[model samples]
Target: MTLTTPEAPAGLPAPTTPGRGRGRSRRAGRADTRLPRARARRPLLFWPVTAAVTAFVLAFVAPFLVIVTNAFKTSADYRNNGPLSWPEEWNWDILADVWERVGFTQKLVNSVQISLGVVLIAVVLALFNAYALGIGRVRWRNAFLVFFLAVNVLPQEGMVYPVYYVFREVGLYDTKLGYTLLIGVVYSAFGTYLLTSVFAGFPRELLEAAALDGASRWTTLWRIVLPMSWPTLSVMCVFFFVWSWNEFLMPLVLLISGENQTVPLGLSVLQGQYSSDPTAMSAAALLGVVPMIAFFLVFQRTLTRGISAGAVK
Candidate 1:
């Protein structure tokens, strides 16, 4: 007996076999089921997280609001009106007065110079150190990293006096160069700790390829590693700059003269023994903060990408 499969109707595709059709239907059902579940959970997940983030932002912004509102008020008005209240009268002259009285321009110059110097020296040293520890086949690499980390945790107060005495003996005390070097050294440990992980995770294949091309380690680092790692490097620079800019203890102890003191030190000078002007103080504080806020805004995109890159694999 002869038998033949039936033909599909004109212009219609052949029907799938029962087993294959069942399998496809099952997969389609699964996809359909999963989509609704995900869609259903999205709002449930989104609103709570949104509410939480909003609360966190408000908490952070509340203090800045207080400072800004009070900064534009007269001291008497600020005192009478309470921190939460709006200023009765806007006194814009307070900023100019505070700026001149605190010698903010000179201190700003000092801060800018010191912060740039610290960032330059610290980032260069950290890049070299991280390259050695992370990429090179060095002995006791883990131990060296641990040592760098330990240096970070060592309290500044513990070493500050000894460092002060040493700087005094070496005639580096109360000098811009001295203060810059001191802060650079203190912050380098943190930079090393941060960059080492980034360097260590770099692809060994690239390093090997560079070696095969007869590129020296320094050449490979500058040409290959550094170009690719700039996001991380830039983030580190921003952090180190901010830290050095705001550093109080080292600059306070090291930079004694009015000419040498940084913005923080200058702000302290503004709060004189006989004068208690909250409005002026607030203006000075706001002035000191403005540059940092501007810096962060300028580098925010790079900073965000760098931080996220570091956080991920």
Candidate 2:
């Protein structure tokens, strides 16, 4: 006899296979979830970071704008209107008057000479010092590095007397070469500390290859290390230049002659023992700041490349 099959209830449909429909359903669910997540990520992190950076830019730029506007204003207008107001007239004469009175051309030359000298000497000294301590693996180098760091922490104020006495006794007093050498060597302590850490992390493979090729330490340093580390060296030069250019107390103490006074020292003359000129002082500030701005603009590409190169390798 033939057997008969069971049938579904009248209103119900048949059940589906487990793997086939379930896999397609899971994929559809994933696609739906990802659409919402991608939409969520579209606004995340970017807007907040952009807003913070914009605020910082404005904070720095606003002061410079105020300075420029005030630099263009006449004494009468500035006195009447206040620092925040726009200039009534753009007076180039104020700048010329300040320039002549300050002997800014002479001061500019002094600053350039001192700053460049400091950078050159400091970079060479730091480079050699770090090479020995870091790559050479000199005896007790860690101890030496620690000592250098401790020296850096010593306040410049405390060392003033000893340095002044030495300079006087050495007959380097009131000369450009005197303080240029002094500041350069003093600043090299920090550079040595910084470069030691960098050199310590240098690739041992490259160093070993140089050694295997019978390259002397000096040859290796000049041919391989120096060229590779040029970015870092450039950064160090920039720092040293800026530091020397802005040096005030040291120059004031060491450079007694009026002709030898740097930008900062010369600008201080405007304060005077008896009287002050506000418009001229503003103009002086503009003159002092312009060189630094120009220097930064010229080196901006170098700085960006240096930082990125450092980050990458």
Clashing pairs in 2: none
Instruction: Report residue 160 deviation for candidate 2 (angstroms).
Output: 1.5
Quality of model 2 by C-alpha lDDT: 0.89
**Model 2 alpha-carbon drift over 4 Å, by segment:** 1-33
Per-residue lDDT over 215-270 for candidate 1, one digit per residue giving the tens place of the 0 to 100 score: 99889998999998888898989999999998998788888899899998877876
Query: Which candidate has the highest TM-score of all?
Result: 2
